[model samples]
Target: MNLERLKQEFNSKKKSILGALASGTDASPKGSVDKQIIPIMELLNSCPDAVTTSSCSGRVSVFLEGRKQSSTTSAPKQEHGADVAAAGGKGGDGRWLFVTHDHLSDDILQEGQDDAIFLDMVFGGIPSEPAAPRLLGQLSSETRYIHFKFEPMILHVLTETLDVANRLLTCAISSSFRESGIVSPLKNPVVAIRTMGLAFDSPVGVYDPERNMIQRFIEPSGLKLLARLTNDRFRENSIRIDSFYRNLLSTMEAPETPLESKQTRALRKKVEGINKGRGIAATRENRVEIQDPLEDGIPFLEDDM
Candidate 1:
């Protein structure tokens, strides 16, 4: 299709999708945009050349993997509440044991408690333990693993053209979202801003159906460490998001300048140092200051774009 025709179609679709989202008729599993990511979403949607199709403002979750269904077997229905589905998982059978988009506090991690009780406090349920023989028998069956994941912010934006997508991708990568890229460039170009390096995922335990118990692979201390690291990543993710938004707005305002210039590279390095907690001092001429959105509050106006 011609570029103009494509832009027309893209804009039409974007309008419909945004309308649905605003009216709470969004077809996404969550049925609405994440509260934390609304500013960025609004910014992108306000731009005439781009619009966000989907996004997540990062999350910490404990997911229970369900048994794989065969061609003959139907998928199991989910019995959990809306929060479980909102966390995002494999399928209907797989559910989130615990999930939160907000940062976790260290107070949630208590020491000296029974592993089961501690897990119950964190995951909202306590699985019953069975006899040794029964446990052994259940271990031989299909293993259902529970995973703890710290997912970073991810956003998908559809742009009017590849140039617009590339500009957004540049801003994303400069903000330390190395995984950001133009996912679809030939048709309606789509830019995905994300970084797997900020994400954390580990198998924390396994479920025993025979015993109706969850066997934790890590101790209380280990879990505490994981929580601490996840929180650290959460803070970094917020910083990166704020940086990306600022960079994108600047790029939009000054589209003539190349985003890969030396100044941009120097700024990216400073942002990287901040993300790593290095506190590296920037040069006098090329300094770039970054603030934590979770701490100092969002610096940008909601309708800045």
Candidate 2:
């Protein structure tokens, strides 16, 4: 379709999706946009050329895979849009045991307990350990496994035209979303903003139905370390997201100039330094209060411009 027609369609779709979000009827598993990414989503949707289709503001999760099925037995169906793909299990049905977009709380950790017990608490299940191994003939029909995962932020956006998509992708990559790219170029162009470098996943344990327990592999200390690292990645993800927002805003305001030009980069660095000195990180909650020249009325000289 032509650019004008594409823009029209995108605008219409944007309105419908935004309306669904407001009404809490969006099809995402969470049923609404994450609060942390709301400002970014709003900013993109405000532009006539772009709208976000899906997004996750990053999360740490414990997932339980469905039971493995025999060749003759078909896998069970998944309900509630359970994220089987994210679990990477053979079974198509898997569910999240525990999930949070924010850093894990310290209360989840307890001294002198096995990681299995901690995981049980996290999943809101009674802590238990396997009492005895099943005999060969008494073995359960299927095996179930659980995993711990920390995923970085990911967003998919549809732009009215390829040029607009490219500009957005540039902003994403510059903000450390190295895996961001144009998913579709010829028609209905979609850009995926993401980074796999910060993703973390590890096998937690296997579940024994007979024993009603999870047998964990990692130690308690190991679990604590994982939580710490996941929280660190969360902070970095937030910083990058803020940078992407600023870069996009600059691109929108100065459409004729390259955002990465030496002068523009220097100006950006100066602004960042000022914010850092003031102990300010541009988060969605505080973005409106930030006084960047780009957002303020301050004008740039011809050379800086």
Candidate 3:
């Protein structure tokens, strides 16, 4: 019943994983392996394929060890000692193993079974897609554990994406933002999709590895900022969607406005600052700050990405 203990355990393990990856202690040469672990743990815990056996070589051995019992059963004992490395060794044939605390000590590992379940719920409960039908269902399930407002969380992710994309677009339109500034604002899509955790730069692409389809927004500007945002605009559309759900829990709670009206307002704002008829803001006194991460990164080049 102690939420604090559960939270502490989750935070500690999460930090440990992130630290291990960042420090190169637990990272794979391909990268994002650490990023993948949280979601994998979540999925397995959520809909566990009981005593599941999986192997890239087409056959796998399952290991179950814990506090309540002492046992070791190995079938196909010939490959019992298969190389279990986080990633490939120089031989380029390393197998991944998923181990739980069950095998260690009964008192500790038994107590940790609930922890694994909790971890599964936390990770598996993340909203991975912007357009999936199950997203609303997931949000409803998530509210049982965390105190987060679903509407805000939805906005947070969408706006974060939009902010990154917008920033990229802005940079592309102007010459102010640098190349390094173009680094991915959001990191791995899987973690964000699965756990709604803070996203960081991953060598991986925008979508989660488990999902083959591209996420909802495909615009170049949207990809860059899909992970970071500090404004309310990101959730504006989601808020409208939330309102239709009759959830009745709103922060800004603005009544839904027409899209044409919104676009007109935005265009008016742009034209108000135009130099003569050109719609570009030209304030010589206000120079763009290069260090501001929120600033757009898309270079104003003649060609588009």
Candidate 4:
């Protein structure tokens, strides 16, 4: 379905859960919810028990802590802490975001008198529910186009409902082991199909209307989508025919200096000077042998006569 219809479906489901919680009723017994509820439930399951510096991976949580300070100043205050170590700010922390496959089922089962509390337990904080249309605007097409929109919304609920400052910093790498489809090396291919972090103002929970950007990585077709985003021929980073030809011509005409100028000169001098060295050496014994041998033979012959 289109974006509008998908959003309506999510809101209706969300309101139902909130209503049940408000009325002090359990939405359902555990695991009795719709199939689309997996993402949110997984998000809930991923929350950390306490803050620690372990290799925790899940979804990052962003929230406001401490009492509200004086808001009467000219500049407003930020809700979430600002630091790279605190990568749980608004607009998401990094190039990735995730929604568990089992979010909705858990939300359905856990929406009780303490539903908000339960949500906080799952996500980091309860964000102000933005206007429905605007909220839809924040959800990327990859998420909206899903056959089950509840999956992503449930994930958002778990992330937005957490009572702590952060959640597990996690992600799902798509599996490369698909049977018929492209069997990429991805571990969790479908996770990429979900929308990324929602853009809002600083402080994590506040939904600023104009200051937001939505992003998503769709699997199976993600490469195609990426090609579209980066295929701008006019972009400088893209290959240019004219530039490539010009570079080729310049390289062809340029003389390749394999040896340095000093080395070439030294080699030439070495070759020329090699011929000037001594070819052979003569000794005085050769001259003496030619002159004395004749004199000795004449004297001996005269005596014999």
Candidate 5:
């Protein structure tokens, strides 16, 4: 393959994307790119052998799960779309509820007054004693809080060579996002790296858009803390991601490779002589020492007999 030509093609497209981004015409989803992450993007795309396909720096969000969208409802729908949340578009498949890059708000939860019809329908017309306290109490088991997600940003990359792919994977795992980074499948032609971490799955609230009922059992202060903590974790992960890529670029460009063993060198030298056009890597003289692609990270193509 003409590797240099392929890289040139990648660069051309990369340039167009960057131009769009700088001119505020980037087609990438809102929230997918933030100013804080621009440095990492530029750092990666600047590499002669690497290109960033997509990336994010992570964010905090508040979401309420509503009943399945009815084909009949004419209300506007908000989505997982960050811009939707920002625009206060509350009707999506379910609204994104709330989203932010920084822990900018101390008030994340909205105060909800009790709903009479909901209490009667689900609680037999008996309000829990002392309406002043215990917002929804055990009715949380009935018409209650659901789950909210706390997610970190993720990034994907394409490297010009398999060796660079493997090295990037190694660097990612060695860094803080160990469980986060994953190598692409052998069939894939590109390398992908991402950041993954804990997400809270506890049911916090629920919404019945049809009934216009929303009941939250958690305190407003608690929600504020959750948002703050989410931002904290996201910022930390962002730093780690930046460091991982910087370290990868610097160390990879000028790697300190270990000296190969004499026996290993001789074996590779012998194998290099074989015509790789055949799946077999050895001749009759070296029949006992053919290398396997899976073991050595080499790709094995099917024979074209």
Candidate 6:
């Protein structure tokens, strides 16, 4: 690949990104694009083999998806609290009780609600969604929610070489964990990094107002701790991402191992980090220590994923 040509192309694209950012047209409901990675993005774009097309630092959201709603197409969360119920059914899509880039505070649980409250989505710069109180599934009026999407920082890099892409992906995976990220190869050649969070692809079982006993197992303090931990993990993931690209730029190289080798390395690194606090081997002889936290009294060991 022509390094100089790549740099020129990156510069052009970077210019457009900066222009759009300056014009305040990112269209993200949470806020303007994150300022944390702009410098890192600039540095990467200056390099010959990389250009960023889009990026997000991360976000935490509380939303309820309608039966027909697709995960990728859900509406933005409500910013104004007072109108959450009245406006809920108004929106054609799902509802968001809370959405933010920063970690939620302890007072989050204190947000008051009334009979089927709907959030207000009319405010400028706030993502707008039609009100729909029916979208939420809750049996008890007393129970609250701790749902969140702790997406870590994600980025799209247009690159020119397999070597560079593989190296970035390798380090990024190890740094963020295996499932946290992936690299997309394209005619334009893009490196897409997706970081993970506590929230899975789907919601936990919906509250059944008609039958299921309200799961009193959820504690406010525990939920708050979970939120805090998830938020902290999200930030930690972002830092890892930063370290990946920044180290690549400075060193101008990454390990040239096979994909699986890189994957194993990253996995081992993750296990090592986790086991720093306690000893539980996740690979080789002690691999079973990970898959099954406890063994039966029978003392039989089996392979599992």
TM-score of each: 0.72, 0.71, 0.18, 0.17, 0.57, 0.51
Supply candidate 5's per-residue lDDT for 187: 24
Query: Could you give me the TM-score of model 3 versus the true structure?
Result: 0.18
Evaluate model 1: give its lDDT. Answer: 0.68
What does candidate 4's lDDT look like per residue over 157-212, in tens digits? 21121111111111110111011011111211111112112112122222232334
Which residue window of length 10 is worst by lDDT in model 1?
296-305
Q: Candidate 3's residue-wise lDDT over 128-195, tens digit each? A: 23345553443321111111111111111111132323322222122211221222333211111111
- C-alpha root-mean-square deviation, each candidate: 11.6, 13.3, 24.8, 36.0, 12.0, 13.0
lDDT of 4 at 80: 48
Segments in model 3 whose C-alpha atoms lie over 4 Å from true places: 1-113, 120-259, 266-268, 271-305
Candidate 5 residue spans exceeding 4 A from truth:
1-16, 28-32, 66-92, 105-146, 180-188, 252-305
Worst 10 residues of 4 by lDDT: 296-305
How many pairs collide in each candidate, listed in order? 0, 0, 21, 40, 9, 20
lDDT for model 3, on a 0 to 1 scale? 0.25
TM-score of candidate 6 against the unseen true structure:
0.51
TM-score of 1: 0.72
Q: Which is the better candidate, 4 or 6, if ranked by TM-score?
A: 6
For candidate 4, the TM-score is 0.17
Clashing pairs in 1: none
Tens-digit lDDT string for candidate 1 (14-94): 988788777878555566667878888888888887888778898888888766433343334333333222233455367
lDDT of 5: 0.49
List per-prediction Cα lDDT, in the order shown. 0.68, 0.67, 0.25, 0.25, 0.49, 0.48
TM-score, cand. 2: 0.71
